[model samples]
Target: MRFSVMDLKVGDRTGSDVFNWNGLLVVSANTVLNADDIDKLQRHDIDYVDIMLRYDGKSPEEKPAAAIPQENETARTYEEAVGGIKLLFQQMLQEGKISKELVDQSFAPLANHIEQEKDVVSLLLTLNNKDDYTYQHSVQVGMISYYIAKWMGKSEEEAVFVGKAGYLHDIGKSRIDNNLLQKPGRLTADEFSQVKRHTEYGYEMIMKSQLPEPIALVALQHHERLDGSGYPNALRSQDIHPFSKIVAVADIYSAMISNRVYQQKQDLLRVLKELHQLSFGKLDAKITQVFIRHMIPNFIGKKVLLNTGESGIIIMTHPTDFFRPLIQINNQFINLSDHHELEIQEIYMR
Candidate 1:
């Protein structure tokens, strides 16, 4: 039977082989459990395992998993925050307007947790949802923006505010036609123009709602580029607000990794490379560098598929060359920086 790790007793045997989220063998079938084994499983973040059960009317005490307290609490917090955001969007669409109270409510539940999270990028990557892309994208952007703000040494309060701003940045998309928003093909020039208007729509909504000025600016300037290449205002580097710079990095990173109606999710490494390119003249170079340097290292220990069709676990990342990391393929180790021709094709997440 499938059982949460906490449900397994010290002497419990595995009924079936247990694998981790990456499809790696965690525990073999028929292996007896012990305290140490359970501890190891917890360290690997294995939430559940299949256990052999006796047909007799006897069982061990039903205890909770030792790891569940904090990690599961974080998961629950994120779920509640996403649900709140979803409802906030629904209300905005129905009413054709937003309120400061509703915007604050959408961001408040996740504030404390976002402040405490050390590696928000990894957490956000793990929590990414392919379904309900829009709502989840907003939540992920908020969490990521909070991390970037903190990385830039912003105060706790400022980081939280930036996160709230990120959450509401795309609220203007609520006014856009749902069919057009989710079309699974290339948009014509007219449709593209409609999509670009989300910035103005979102900006006006936040401004009218009486929210903080910076939050409204983030909505307005998120699509504005540093090189005068972005949409709407097309403001250059000096014209854009710092808050918008942070959100732009977060928004681009989150959207590239996320599956959209018209596009499949891009590889994380590839997305990071593109961000590096954009950082040169289009994006905030300092902010983008800070994001890539801190966030790329978290990919270590993650399983990945390579361009050569081989799958491996990331072992180490280069300090300067963020894209290529040392990976363990079978019993062999290959440093991607040394093998210039090969590249990471995809990253597997659970």
Candidate 2:
């Protein structure tokens, strides 16, 4: 079967791919669908249907092979796992004993789930739904760090360890008071000091647990800068572990993109710009370049409205100048770097 984006109405059977009553993706096989699942699909504006047929255990010869609807299974599963991790942290804060069984039971499955789908962008985007900043930030860092590790050609085991370190990097923030953590104004010197304590607190918390030594080390060192400007410990570039360096970049990127109670979410392009600027002193220049070149490109698709009232789809991205990209509007290629008049005013994801 050929893949076609067609408006599907309820009860329409285009082929083996049956359009649900609500025009969501559904297979004609004997499986049950749920209300939440349908609602989630609708939220993403997946109203078009595409059908794919298999013959002799292979996809049928079709010119336009169906574009598979991006599955949120990996995302959903990762979110659930992060939720469990959050719960464990909450329990720990309450002085409740963290059982090794619970930690293994929760993280082991999450590790396996992340391993199945190596696409880190989808994983990070999926985990962004969490309303809580700490939990969402943790998952984002994990996914981003995992992607960085993979890009560096690290082994699967090393990548997973990097991911685990990222996930637990901010566990010490659990001890910080909610008022200070969620404050909307600039923090006072004392408040900033308290905020800085999270690194040490997270390190101590992880040290007490059954997690591996490298994971705990990452929690402590993620804040340390290459120029000895980072917090908890002013370790220089050589003093910092490679995993910590990876986590540091991921953590800063996620924090910059995320909307906190005190601060609005920074523009995606602007955040990348800031990261690039800071790469010289704080972040690893090579990894920062990799993140900007590879990871940042994934968030830039979908249509955008230019400041000149021209709208278009982002066609190309620049590694060094992330804020600028070539746009296709009305069948014309407008390069933002050259056409300074045409600036992206807003992005429309549909």
Candidate 3:
């Protein structure tokens, strides 16, 4: 079975050779992991691996299953959600339709779990895996959309519904050609146009299925922007559905921070900055601000590396200066809002 590096204990044995994102070997097949091995895997940002078995006290035959560390339970849940989405996507491509029952099974667990899990920063680390970017992106967008809805004062039921919308936003892509979806190189002009049709494809698919109108609209209009620069249909602010706007914000944030075949993952803080910039004309300002406002506070105790090659703990965040926070190095305090020359090069959410 596949286990997240976060979930693997010291005694767990790898079922296959483990490699980092750059394809460098980190661990050999069937290697019995120690504390350092686990730490090295975490440092390498290796998300998951195939585990043959685990070694407990008595003997390998009598060994019990590993107990998930409380800290890593969320990552385990994320892995399950990713698997569910992969199954659902495969079913859609084969069947040419969505199953509401399958959608609930795949997405509901993660959505319910994330609401209780307050460590939003850590989610950025564990919820992502480059191998299955599409499935992982769907889960992230759904979770983020739910948070945006709740933060914006929507009722609980309403928020969950909006989340379902976000979860299915890309279901249309299931009907698209497999070659185009997996292409690593630049997409041709006509290929890009065909890709854009996923919006209409998703809308039609959902409408034909048992899901509601709002979810269908989200699939169709998640790409639409406030300034009418989006695809499928050039929908201005009012013409776009409110739920779609929430999904749009979630979609952009998830896509930017995710590691994909064609695009490398951007720094989390830098992606937030880009979102803030997009809020002006491309995205809905209120919804984007709500997401950013709630997300920036998660950096309070995070470790950050500065552009000057120094590292510090984020002690406090500035209200006016969203990205730059008050960082503490030993007993010295650096207020990044005041030091405009210094910049946060990276934020260590994990």
Candidate 3 lDDT over residue span 228-309, tens digit each? 9997899999899999999999999999888776888876877999999999999999998878866765565678888899
lDDT by candidate, in order shown: 0.78, 0.67, 0.80
Write one digit per residue (lDDT tens) for candidate 2, span 1-350: 43333332222223443433433222322112223223333433445444333222233332111222335556566767678778868866986335556665655567666553432443454455457888888877887787688667688788877887887888888889988888879999999999999888877777787667788889899999999999788999999988999999999989977778877665456677788888988898988876765544444345777778777876656434557876788779877888776666555453
Instruction: Score every model by TM-score.
Output: 0.78, 0.75, 0.77
Instruction: Give one clash count per candidate, in the order shown.
Output: 1, 1, 0
* CA RMSD per model (angstroms): 10.3, 9.6, 12.5
lDDT of 2 at 312: 85
Candidate 3 steric clashes: 0
What are the runs in model 1 whose C-alpha is more than 4 Å off? Answer: 1-68
**Per-residue lDDT of 139 in model 1:** 88
Please identify model 2 stretches exceeding 4 Å from their true place.
Answer: 1-70, 96-101, 115-129, 296-300, 307-310, 319-322, 341-348
- Looking at candidate 3, the ten consecutive residues that score lowest on lDDT are 62-71
Which of the predicted structures, 2 or 3, would earn the higher lDDT when compared with the native? 3
Best by TM-score: 1
Q: Higher-lDDT candidate among 1 and 2?
A: 1
Pick by lDDT: 1 or 3, better one: 3
Worst 10-residue stretch by lDDT in candidate 2? Answer: 28-37
